[model samples]
Target: MRQQSSPHLSRGFSSYGCALALAALVALAACSKKEAAAPAPRPVVASIVHPDGQALQAGSLPGEVQARYSTPLSFRVGGKIIERRVRLGDTVKNGEIVALLDPADAQKNAASAQAQLDAAQHNLVYAQQQLERDKAQAKENLIAPAQLEQTTNAYASALAQRDQAQQQAALAKNQLQYTTLVAGHAGVITAEQADTGQNVSAGQAVYNLAWSGDVDVLCDVPESALAAFAVGQNASVTLAALPGRKFSARVRELSPAADQQSRTWRARLTLAQPGPDVRLGMTADVTPAVPLATAAAQHGLFTLPATALFHEGRQPAVWVVRAADNTLELRRVTVTRYDERTIVVSEGLKDGESVVLQGVHTVSAGEKVRAIAPLHPEDFAS
Candidate 1:
């Protein structure tokens, strides 16, 4: 009986062992499935950096449209402005009267000068008759030689006085003409310094005239940007008031000295051919089209698309791709500046290194990626 019971217990123990082995096999199969379901490396777009050959960027700055030949118009004589024939923004032809001074005093002086000349002429005639009579008397031995000498001296003095009166009359006529302030050239009035009923002195600027001619885009450049500009350099100008229109220009003048108050160099870009739409005092945007060689030297900066920039807190950073394995690593960079199209990286980037241009946010550290060439190198600059 004991031998039979031992065989039953051994069979039960064998069954329990079989169940434990099955459970172990099932656990092993679940572990294999989890390993197979592991996520694959995320695919991301990137580009190889050709930092050295990147084109130098173009820059834009605020500017203003101004007349190339602006001058202050003034009257040559002093008086009250009785009439202003031209108003601000009025176009005037050469020699066209712009303002008028009261002619009452000038006319009075002219009349007085004429009267004095008439009196002098009458005196000269009398003196001449007296001299002639004295000479005749002397010839006839009816008068002393001293009387003839006195008559001759009086005639000479009268002749001198007559000549002086004539000069005074001419001067008075000139003063009267000067009362009419006329435009020296065909131009548009930009400013009116004096108005009707206001007294102005000689040469006091009464009207600011902008001569009709070539136009200029005026801008003030800081000391740092002065090196980027030179005379004869080509540029493009666009007016804020006239959208979608671009005018060609060239650097015509550069101030030799910096402005004392602003410490900036005043630059003037003359338009090649300005149309009627281009008016004086219109705001403009001046973009200097610097040559690639000159620009590269002036701006030795690495440029990347603005999208490539990522902010880690307040710090700016970018994702650099490893060339060997196509993996990414977040790199902190010192940004020099940024414009509408590109971010200028001043430091923390080496030449000939790879950087992820797009999908910067989608990438993770050490994730594999596929590097694709950009459509154009300049796109990176943008």
Candidate 2:
């Protein structure tokens, strides 16, 4: 009687255990699905959009101190260069002789012209005396009228020959003076093109002269920055050789066309009162004096880090954070230009708005994010 057991009751207990295990598995799967559906908020490095006017005004371009008038000094007549009075870097005064040519040939031509002129004068005097004699003989009827007329004609021819010889003599004298090259203005010799004993043709360059009076800062400005520079604009110039000093300057000239090789326009800025220490060829930096607020208002530009820019298809876009819910929205922006470390946005942004500075590729539209300042802030300094 003790050994007897109910097999139906044991089977009922086994079925109850299986039902409990299936319910526990279902609950755990639901929890896993919930976690996969909602993700944690991502942290992003970001920066506030700011007006680019200050950045544009802070731009400094490399330049060189130069002369306002730089010209090549050359000879007016062809000859051999016998002597060069001034060397490179020598200061010359107005009307000072800079070089000399061999005067042997010029002197000979001048002397020959003078001798011809003297002979013509003697002939002229003889013709005048003969004309007086012919007039007296014609009045007394002691000589034929035709002979007197011929003598008068001879006098006129002599006078014409004398006038021709006088002009030739004057031209020969000028050529003799041209053998010496004189400086037209007070300036410094910057270059020497023809050396001593070198045979040069007429109007050949001998030395390059930089006029002494006004100094200029010459710079090659890229096409993008050309808009900031205009004629009569004020600027500040600093030289590398003369540190701790800044010279006031004004924009004097700008090239109408861009250079073919560098695609930069040449700008000439005249210094107001350059010191003696400002030498030619010294490296300089030129900063325009345009107001930051004015420049920003005029251009309507904003600046952002290069890492913040993203491309959708062929168009450039940026990620802007929505202030209401800290969500991201992909915005298409119009880029005015691109620098090495930054992008200049002309539209599609506003001041004080936070934009993603990094990790732009990993974020999605409408995703929740926490905006944080960039760890390496120096990257966006430009």
Candidate 3:
């Protein structure tokens, strides 16, 4: 304004001011650049599922193996044990001799009876000849009638004596046959009840045998489960000794009374065609198959790992169910059975429900918790 300033000087001042303003704007823009994008929100989660639940059938059961027809072996007549031909665990056929009683006295008695019988027979022949001679004499008038009558009576007496002696001989022969002990059927001798040289009474048990054709299993089932089993129900059987092998059996008999000590009942089952290797007294497991008509089920069961099981008043229970509105329900569970991994719940659960399988110790009723998604359920393998 003072010198109306030279045009070049005025232009240069304006350009310098413009350059300063532009620099200030660039600085503001650098400050306005956004911070790193925030981390994605953590996914909502519920209970974690380890393994899953499978549909259960009433057909599966725990059972035991047992012999269908087992009886003690013994002799019909009493005698001193002379020899035992078979030891424990020996198989024998029907009528096969298993043992021998001391037969010294029996043989002697039989021989004596036979000699007496033979002597009686000889006497009877002589008596018959004498009686015929007397009758002929009386007819020829050489003998008195009274004398003939006496001779006839004497012959009849001799015949009676001979018959009596013959019966005695037969008795001796029967006693001799009783000295040998034989098996009644093809079976395995499970035990030796008496030893050699021991005096045994008539019908005394000597050995226990399990017959081949008739085989059955006996199990002491819990009293509560006794009603579940009925005669003629089909079942599966197994032995802990013979792993991976299962046999078929049926409930043939049920004990009417329960055991006083264990509150259990005895159930006998018939086996289907046992093999040669199947021995008596071996441990067995029998499982009764539940007919589909009687098998019942429920819905909304919560699957829990076996580890979640803990004793509550000697009964099994589980923590179950949480609501988004912060409500909790503690449920007591009846454990049907379990293997290494899972516990089968018979009560206290509904399908598609949540349970505190893990973190059971940490969780409490009515406590607020962030629920994560449950794992997928598993399918059952045949």
lDDT of each: 0.83, 0.88, 0.70
User: Candidate 3's residue-wise lDDT over 199-251, tens digit each?
Assistant: 99989999998776777777776423544467787888887777898888778
Please give the distance, in angstroms, between residue 289's alpha carbon in candidate 2 and its true position after superposition.
3.2
Better of 1 and 3 by TM-score: 1
Q: How well is each residue in 257-357 modelled by candidate 1, as lDDT tens digits?
A: 98876656899999998999888999998877764334444554567888788877789998987878777888899987666766768677776778778
RMSD of each: 11.9, 6.5, 16.1
Better of 1 and 2 by lDDT: 2
If the candidates were sorted by their lDDT against the true structure, best first, what order would they fall in?
2, 1, 3
- Using TM-score as the yardstick, the better of models 1 and 2 is 2
Indicate which candidate wins on lDDT.
2
Clashes of each: 0, 0, 22
Model 3 TM-score is 0.57
The residue-by-residue lDDT of candidate 2 on 1-382, one tens digit each, is 5786699999999999999999999999999999989888889998787676545545688899999999998887899999999999999999999999999999999999999999999999999999999899899999999999899899999999999999999999999999999999999999999999999999999999999999999998754465567899999999988889989999999999878766578999999999787789999989878743555656677777788899988999999999999999999999976777878788898877899988899999999999988787897675
